[model samples]
Target: MLRRLALTAVVSLAVLSAAAPGAAAASGPLPLPSPLPLTLPLPLPQGEDDARTRLTVTVSEAGDPSAEGIFELECAPVGGDHPAAEPACDRLAELADEGTDPFAPVPRGAMCTQQFGGPATARITGTWRARHIDAVFSRADGCEISRWNNLRPVLPGVR
Candidate 1:
């Protein structure tokens, strides 16, 4: 009887050991935290897009770094220390909605003057609706002059 019990216990132990493990489910792949391991979407669209527009606006005489004046401009209900935030934001919004290139080179088809407004240069660096902006602005030509004139409100100190 003792021998039989020992054999039966051994058999039971073997069976239990041979049994497959219980299927403990797991929630696959823990969700990544917000702003976690992210990348900006590439290959931005042409014309105006939905990219957030932020700018580090700079202006100076062409080739003169010492004279450069810079400001910050933020739009979409603009909030920044920029002096002309309200009008600037409004104008910018209008241009964007109208599909105007706020930084376009002089139009080849349009007639423009040969007058030298100045050798001033402007650079706008920031993100504009998902697109990166490192645009250079100038008053070197008719188109550039037109571009500068159109953006004067946002630029400040320009008549």
Candidate 2:
């Protein structure tokens, strides 16, 4: 009887351990072997002056070769700058719809470009606002991941 009890306990422990989360070995990194580069275009605010800024972003899986690309971004100031303590920038998805192409598949080993629009107003300085824009590109054949934005100011000495 003691032998049977011991055997049952061992089986139950093994079953419980296997049921635990993350119990299985991890699959290695994503299958993709290279990074995806992107670019963005910026827009200026109405009646306000703005210029295009170039941006580069590379997205790759762990243990994969880095892929890179350059793009343009446009932005303008509409609302005056807010308190430094609070982030003055917020991502506007509706703006992205104006100029940006919906996600499309890319050819393997080839690069493609797409444009996207941004918010109508962004705070540049205390009580100042600006317009914004973006452009994105990626290699063909990769999955269409989600979109992202970088609202941090690029101007020097402008916190």
Candidate 3:
């Protein structure tokens, strides 16, 4: 009788051990603890593009108003009173495509030629690729002249 009872207990323990995982699953998964509050920025919609490129360009000579001019330029569709809107827009687009900031300034402490370009100065302001742009151009030095010339047609030729 004693042996039989011991055998029965052993068999029952084996059966229970085998069924333990299945029994827990059958009873359904345990509830997960609630997550903490999280703040996530919403993503922009698909097909959306950066802000339109619209700008006001002002060019002035130190002592010559006849050489001074102000023009509004709108790009992406290329409109406004700019004389070379299409070409200007093309140059800006090319710069952006190449991951270069067209309005970026010359690096500090870098060597530049001491050549003087002239007394022409220009200011460009407004938006490009959704960022505020307020850049100044001048032919004060070689680096400045190169910067001004690179953005051609955008800044009318000034000699």
Q: What TM-score would each prediction reach against the true structure?
A: 0.57, 0.20, 0.65
lDDT of 3 by residue, 43-87 (tens): 224654333688999998835565478888898788899888899
For candidate 1, write residues 1-159 as lDDT tens digits: 999999999999987776634322244554643421222234346665543777888877745454367878787758776678788878876666665667655544555567776768788888766557787887766666777778767765443
Better of 2 and 3 by TM-score: 3
Provide the lDDT at 71 for model 1: 74
Off by over 4 Å in 2: 1-5, 16-40, 50-159
Candidate of highest TM-score: 3
lDDT-better candidate, 1 vs 2: 1
lDDT of each: 0.67, 0.31, 0.78
Once model 1 is optimally superposed onto the true structure by TM-score, how far is the C-alpha of residue 51 displaced, in angstroms?
7.9
Best by lDDT: 3
lDDT of 2 by residue, 1-159 (tens): 999999999999998888664444465444754554442433445665322222222222212222111112223432322222122122323223343322222336654344322221221211112332233332221232222223322211110
Q: Report how far off residue 53 is in candidate 3 (Å).
A: 0.3
Please give the range of 10 consecutive residues that has the lowest summed lDDT in model 2.
119-128
Candidate 1 lDDT score at position 99: 59
Displacement of the residue 71 alpha carbon in candidate 3, Å: 0.6
